[model samples]
Target: MSNIFTEAEIAYLESQPLGRLATVGPGGRPHVAPVGVFYDPQADAVVVAGHAGSGFGGSRKFRDAQAHPEVAYVVDDLASLDPWQPRGIEIRGTAETFSDGGEELGARITGVMPFDAAWLRIRACRVLAWGIDGDSFELSARDVA
Candidate 1:
């Protein structure tokens, strides 16, 4: 219904290149892994390139997302070690797997993977952010488009 990301949140997303993606696997198991991520402002979603894996046909994250679209992704950092200021955003959304020609990859993550990678696009349903706006935080449940 409204954009869950503020100007600062978007800036943070742009500044960060890595995030943790969490997904559910068989037997109700939770799987989380570090991944290269980029925020697609045009899509209003987080984009992650899928790496080819030996057993799963794609990365574990891709398979997990395919099986269970509901997932959570977080990108965070310690803004101040002494003051203990932790800044980050958690995105809860449904993931959609698709093929990409690698054109969407940005310079921030281009050297991290190969071209023609599969992609997981997470459309945000809820967003929670903290320390992104000088210690202010908020949660948005409406569709962010």
Candidate 2:
């Protein structure tokens, strides 16, 4: 498979520090949270971190991932200027949760999460990017990296 992100797409994604992460919850409900996100060019993944005791809902996202990895995350730029609108990204991928300490992935999350926060990181296994206006495209992690 090819990468889902282009040079411009990657740059755009990285430029945004906040995004709404969606995860399926009980009864197929969707839980969305605004999180600090970072894109790793080498890993070809988007990483999000949370505190160990953050909230039941946050942990639910991981459970949803374990139960069903199929997930979608949104990162968009919202502006109120001449452009009149902002661009956005919708990344669809298998979600994975890792808690082991000291690995590079863990460190990356630590860097982004609050100092007192424990880490629950979500790495984008696959990404599908689209423009809010209507244009859309998809890219695999490999290609994105």
Candidate 3:
């Protein structure tokens, strides 16, 4: 894996606890899920982990990724209400669904829910970040190579 995110972007991602993952569902519809977010530098990808039960390896987003392979993830926050500020990062990429990582990485992912280690790994093809490069709330876009 290659590093496509900047230091600031990585820091911002790791600091955030949740993200929205959008996957292609049945009939080409969009299915979005609120997920526990983690930036795994070792994997060089954004890892979305959530609860999985005995009957399934993961949730709907995982199934959709396995079927469609393309997905989008966004992590955002209201930096301030006093002055009305927002900051966020959006990643569009190819997604992979996997099980059996929980034992090793469960400690790393965020969220209060208990997870079975199943995760959706996103290999970013393009990334757009806002309010991260500096104090300015401008946007920065990049293509991962």
- Cα deviation of 11, candidate 3, in Å: 1.2
**Candidate 1 overall Cα lDDT vs. reference?**
0.75
Q: lDDT scores for all predictions?
A: 0.75, 0.59, 0.80
Q: At residue 67, what lDDT does model 1 achieve?
A: 93
Q: Where does candidate 3 have its weakest 10-residue lDDT segment?
A: 50-59
Model 2, span 1-80: residue lDDT tens: 11556676677776787888787877888888787656766556676655444542346665676666666788877544
> lDDT tens string, model 1, 32-144?
99986677766667887754332223678888999999999999998888877888888999999875544445333444545344677888888878888767344433445
Candidate 2 vs. true structure, TM-score: 0.67
Candidate 3 per-residue lDDT over residues 49-100, each given as its tens digit = 6654533354677788999999999999988888877889999999877777
List pairs with backbone clashes in candidate 3: none
The estimated TM-scores of all candidates read 0.80, 0.67, 0.85
Candidate with the larger lDDT of 2 and 3 = 3
| Model 3 local distance difference test score | 0.80
Candidate 2, which segments miss by more than 4 Å at Cα? 51-58, 102-145
